[model samples]
Target: MPEPAGAEDWMPRRLAARRAVITGAGAGIGRAIARRFAAEGARVLVADIDSGEAESVARELGPPALAHAVDVSREESVAAMIGRAVDEWQGLDVLVNNAGIGIAANTPDTGIEDWRRVLDVCLTGTFFGMKHAIPLLRAGGGGAIINMSSVAAIVGVADRAAYCAAKGGILALTRAAAVDHAGEGIRVNCIAPGTVDTPWIERITRGYDDPAAARAAMEARQPHGRLVSPEEIAAMAAYLASDEAASVIGAAMVVDGGMTAR
Candidate 1:
């Protein structure tokens, strides 16, 4: 069985006293990151398009966490979300641009709308987050930004053309931002996750003729023979958000069960 979530040892409080905003914190990887950050002593703004989910996650994290409704694809919404964090904490230490969606279709079968939607959320959303958050980070005397990419960005996955393209864009963006801001003490990095066992994966498999078989196939393709857990990705985010990663900039940290190794 996969090991349970969280640090194996005592919590290191790596992010102690940090102020953070995580997009899409209503569920899955975002939620996990919020929880982990709270455990590490950071106050978090749990922002999500789903107000209720965001509220629930914020409440779960208690007084240190605030829930904010946000649609990352919209510039105004992204701006407001970051503004709230700044108002609440006076500045920001970390921003996790984790909101994203995937459309399962090859380029030929992909509709224009679907392509635009995927890019809007996955790629443009990251762009918006960085655009709005960078100045605040600069004002705060430097901070960290963790953008969520995917193995799809590093290796081609059949029928995920839009996802691949958007995630690929994230890596390039991370590199540019890292270079642009590194001298200012602002570090930018991305996490390239493998197929994580999240509700999103379940939703994706439902479209398959045999959801079980499809999930199994996904697992088999991973060298580790299991789906990556959301918590694992969260752990990486925590590390990147910490001062320990002071020298780690423009890096794409892969946590994919060795999916790209094959």
Candidate 2:
């Protein structure tokens, strides 16, 4: 059995004794969530499509931490991921569907294949995680599910037609899952972040004519005039995973620096 969180964990050890699996944990927000969950005393499984990166993160987190290569878009891969957790930890608890990508394309530029790819990974991938995880969670006496959404899910962003559509779909999926599973002690929620400072954003900005100006423009979207951090999102995930958020059901916790307030 995994050891209960010590007093030295982040956020006062909110997620003690929990076992969590975070997808796309190779880098960015997924990586932050894995680390944060570990710090809070949970044994984390760093799941990513990239085996090397996932193993690296697992090694970084040390004992009780394991790495697995999983392609969220594939149902078999997702099933294997959940199975590994239950097999290794003897049960399951929390799951973070954080693997996603963005394609710079408007409705016009969004080809059929492009749309399918975005939806497959961002939307269907979340579905696979939830579908396979729910049973294990119920067996383990219920747990929390936090899906990673975006500001685009709530509002709109130009040239992100496919991405926005997929994110928006996640909101609907989250709510439905929460309502269906609440009676079983499962709490489903999502974090809709805006302009988070992660490797993804850095890559997007680097493609711009002036990376600095691109960053400034991205930051300007949020009221705080800066991008949110991966650590910040992880903090909220910790709270959601804990019993403290027992009442927070089907809620889309917007940690977008008040970007949607405008």
Candidate 3:
């Protein structure tokens, strides 16, 4: 893959000639990962359902970073996104399945539509990303796949029946994919994060009568009394994408400020 302009000096040789595809690249952890990967010399395809934000992020990263509107839940869309990556960057070396949604409906009150929507994006979407990305990675002699899971995957959380179920499925999916592909040189893993300070959390608290109280509740739940930053999660992601984490597979690295530890 060709190096983007102005990124020649700072790009790491380890990743300089590689290409990465990150879903949900419109904001938060996904955006951070795209920027970090581009800085390290990896050509990136920032895929998101929000085309505007995705394009903005890609432009900010300059050349070699392109934007594509992708609905990861759809097989055709995911295949197109992967095809674009291969066509643009020549080959793919990393896949970050970061697209997801969180629904707060309790199990009893959750509608079938809502349940399927959450599962479609968080679990099924991730599966599709892996399914489409595997062939590309194998064609390129193998690569890394990072799936974004959540602390809910490891623990039972209230008022998040669908979200938890989807996330839990992601944990199992990660392990299964890792075991099945390790011999083929593909490294599959998931990152389970606690409450990260992202727009998603902000939106979740917006309608609360006492937003402050709701925010406080979340903070109190974390042992550190604060939410994790997107950068912190991105640091771990960058490590996993690098050769440094060659042996890390089927692992769900947690970054929840000890929330699940309790």
Name the candidate, 1 or 2, with the larger lDDT value: 1
What are the TM-scores, per candidate, against the unseen true structure?
0.96, 0.96, 0.94
Q: Deviation in angstroms for 246 in model 3? A: 0.5
Alpha carbon RMSD to native, model 3: 2.5
lDDT of 1 by residue, 1-262 (tens): 2222233457788887799999999999999999999888888999999999999998887877899999999999999999898789989999999999998899999999999999999999999999999999999799999999999889999999999999999999999999999998899999999999999999989989999999999999999999999999999999999988999999999999999998
What candidate 1 gets wrong by more than 4 Å, as runs, is 1-9
lDDT, each prediction: 0.93, 0.92, 0.89
Cα deviation in Å at residue 53, candidate 2?
1.0
RMSD to the hidden true structure, all candidates = 3.5, 2.1, 2.5
Q: Compose the digit string of candidate 2's lDDT tens values, residues 74-106.
A: 999999999999789988899999999889999
lDDT of the structure predicted as candidate 2: 0.92
- Kindly report which residue stretches of model 3 are placed more than 4 angstroms away from their true locations once superposed: 1-14
Alpha-carbon shift of residue 160 in model 1 (angstroms)? 0.7
Ranking under lDDT, best-scoring first? 1, 2, 3
Clashes of each: 0, 0, 0
Residue lDDT tens for model 3, 123-241? 99999999989988888788999999999999998999999999999999999999999988999999999999988988988879998888899999999999999978877888899
TM-score of 1: 0.96
